[model samples]
Target: MTQPPATPLPPPRERRRLRESKSLSQAQVAERVGVTRETVRSWEAGRSTPKGRKRTAYATFLASVEAEHAPAGTVAPPSLNSRSAGRHGSAPLTRSVEFVQPPVRTAEPVNCPHPTRPPKTAAEAFDRLYTHTAPALVRQTYLLTGRRTLARESVERAFQLAWQRWPEVAVDRDPAGWVRAAAHEYAMSPWHRLRPSHRRPEAPPADAADRALLDVLLSLPPAYRRTLLLYDGIGLGLPETAAETEATTPAAANRLLHAREAVAEKLPVLAKPERLHERLAELAGAEKLQAPKSTLVRTDGERRTRFWTRSAIAFTVLIIGTTALTLRTAPTRYEPVPAPGAVISGVPPQMGPGPLSQADKKLRATLRGSGRGGPHRLAPEAG
Candidate 1:
């Protein structure tokens, strides 16, 4: 004779109760099923009902658990709110259980150089580039300009320019290099040179000698100052420094060598490479330059709008002013008749029209004779 069929397992809630009653932790059950404890929790809480193999696995585990605790032929208790509980008129063995799925989580995409898709707009790309590079750029700029305000202004203005030309900037192989060069140019702008400094701010110094070294560094020509900063202050190689400053490797190396000599002449304490690097680091820290907030950087659309608006206004003003000037200074075809008294010729001035020809006089006589010298006539003769 065949054996009787196995009893069906109760719902998810009852299964959990049965497991807890048996003192089997969710971990043990999860390990048996090859899923996470959280997954097992989801199964038991009914937030996510298992399907196919997972369902089968869960039912089997629950059945085994129930069988192990309770004797054969005993019916497991109904789960909370299950139809079986109401049909059987059986009170819940325990208080009602509630199931809530943990909130579904989504990972935010990070902006990085190697993202699967490039940033949607040039502004996004530029901002990402700025976020990653601005601090180091400011530090380098501070080293070059020797003035905190000037360095900060240079970096900000360079970023603004970068935002304006983001399309070109976004695709650059070395976006930081481009920004560095731009900041350098801004730091050394003739406009900045023309303005005299009211007072020189003191550098952050290890001692008196560090301040003297910085002063000498600032006193060097812009080219030498920038080369030394990139090579030492920023720790770029000779070729990279050359590329940043738009100089050949040999020229950058030569400038760096001479810059070291100049610094040594001014401050004998920093003549050694190790000594110079330490002093540069001290200066970089003292400047305390920060990366500008991304929000402070305007988007590509805003920059484009401002540029086009200014261009249109300028073009309109130029056109209007040019028209006015052309009208004012333009040469005329004929000279004005001399003033009444100033007439050089003895003949009377021909103010209105020259005297009518003898033929014209005859024509007038004929028109009057024909009664055509009235306002209705088409010719002046009518008047």
Candidate 2:
């Protein structure tokens, strides 16, 4: 009978045959390859693939099989150590290789999104989101740190950063959450920490009395202050707070409650916002001062709206002015002229919406666990 024609071997099969020919088991080949026997078995069955550095690794294993089988007279003389060393990136064939195979590893790294997050010029990102977020970030920070100047500076720096990577960050699951996180990071920066004047902030609003309270709150560790603000000011739930602050839900809740108790015990003045401001102011006056010029976010909404509105209007006028000049100087009068100022006067229109719509507000409020029976009350003794 005619011998069956020889078929060229696949990579895995070739590797496996090399082992079998050397009288080595799957486990032995796996040991040479620095992998488990199951991996070798999978390779033999063609149930898996090995690529990249691992491909070189497998080739090295086959080379080792050839060397081991040398005593058995199966390996061809010329096709021995020389070829394997070159393929395995080891020393020249004159020297022996001490093979160290890698163990089977599937999860090697965290899947970072940075590579694919769109490349954004930081300035472009800031220009897109700064106006929308800077004010709230500033206000929230001021409330927490009691340092209006530092808060103002902190928000600007944070938003500046956000702007730098706007495309990448805005596409994240929660852009606002990113803003909050950025603000926190900014608050902890050396620039913010070094400026001592910002520690005792101007009292919130009209309260001269809240200064004392503010001082006490500001004196707490940063974690406590952040926990307090996210809980008391942002009204975040425990789990939501955990996601924001990088804590477990129970930990976040306990932190909030603990911080609240600490603040109350340390400075009872916060029970009344007015008194809190006054006390902080007194503390500031009594403390030997470090006078860094601070930026304050003292303006209320209408002022901010006017400031941005004026800016937008001024920008429009400049654009129109430039366009008009371009049209006059152009080789053709047919170049499209801009419409009158009235058209774009309504541009960006107004602040329009707040954090969410009323419907969304209700839904979020509903999700807040109903505050049912006020957290302390049990369910009517289960009837």
Candidate 3:
């Protein structure tokens, strides 16, 4: 028999939203669907589609989930075929299936005042994002680091970075998330410990319970603390928390578990995750963690970019100048020079004529005595 037509799956993003709404992790979904977690990820990311039996299984799972979460009186359209019904023991699938669309609210004007128009310029877009997200992000950073100044600084810096890369940030799926990750990284940087200002701890919350919760949170490792904040404090799904924390799903789960246990051990009242989340929100809200103005952030980012750019140019020019000067002053040709003469030692001095030899002295005396003409006469008589 011919295989049943492929199941009509929801859009990739919708599939992920459905899973997360059901509080199901990729690993959990993968297990139930008899596939690897990577396979499920690929399917959700639209990198690949499930085929044959897996396709039907995945579609069935998503449809059932959607149906369960659908509003009252709404139903998910059936996409299963007769072959699928026979295998699952459901009613025989019909060829024609109609999808049910939710009722649209038309009472409100199409141009509502609340939803602002899209930003026309990059600066406007960046400012809009900063204004919308900075306040909460500052508070979140405060919870992450427990330093008010650092919290505001982190948010400001993260926005500056975002402004610097506006093209990337504007097109990002979650600009707030991009900035949040940057802020979290800056707040938790190991280098911050070296600063004299950060060397001392910030004051604890005034309320006893708030103080206690903050202490418990700060006592945990930074990784564990961040995981708890993202998962419990921010209500992010496990995959999202893991992705934010740069960890695997299992690793994020482990961190969350350990963090929760630590918090609960210290503060029994916050044993429940929900209670912990509430306490965290309360503590963060109580702080005076205000972010800088969006205009200031944008200006600072531009100023910082200019400063670095000019500094780089100046440094390059200095290097070029120094190299040119060296080349100009350097010797062009080789010149050889004789070494200075040194005194020779260790030779016997010449004896002053060593007293003229005795024979030479006698001949000199005889010549002097016979120098007269008598010597010449005596020589002639002998000839």
All models, RMSD in angstroms: 26.7, 35.1, 19.2
**Model 2: how far residue 233 lies from native, Å:** 0.5
TM per prediction:
0.51, 0.36, 0.61
Better of 2 and 3 by lDDT: 3
Evaluated with TM-score, which candidate comes out highest? 3
lDDT of 2 at 69: 42
TM-score of 1: 0.51
For each candidate in the order shown, give its overall lDDT on alpha carbons.
0.63, 0.51, 0.71
lDDT of 2 by residue, 294-316 (tens): 12222232355578899999999
Give the alpha carbon lDDT tens digit for every residue of 1-383 in model 1: 99554445466656665654453456677888778877876666566777666667878888777566443322222221121121112122111122111111111223443432456766556655665456556766777776777877788878888777877877676566677788889988867755667255544555665567667987998899887776655545565667768898778878988998999887888877756766775566555466556556565336766888999999999999999999999986877887665657788766877799999999998977878544654556654
Candidate 3 lowest-lDDT run of ten: 93-102
Which stretch of 10 consecutive residues in model 1 shows the poorest summed lDDT? 98-107
Q: Write the number of the candidate with greater TM-score, choosing between 2 and 3.
A: 3
Best by lDDT: 3
Instruction: Write the residue-wise lDDT of candidate 3 on 21-116 in tens digits.
Output: 454556779999999977886776677999998998999999898776444322211111111111112112111111111121111121223333
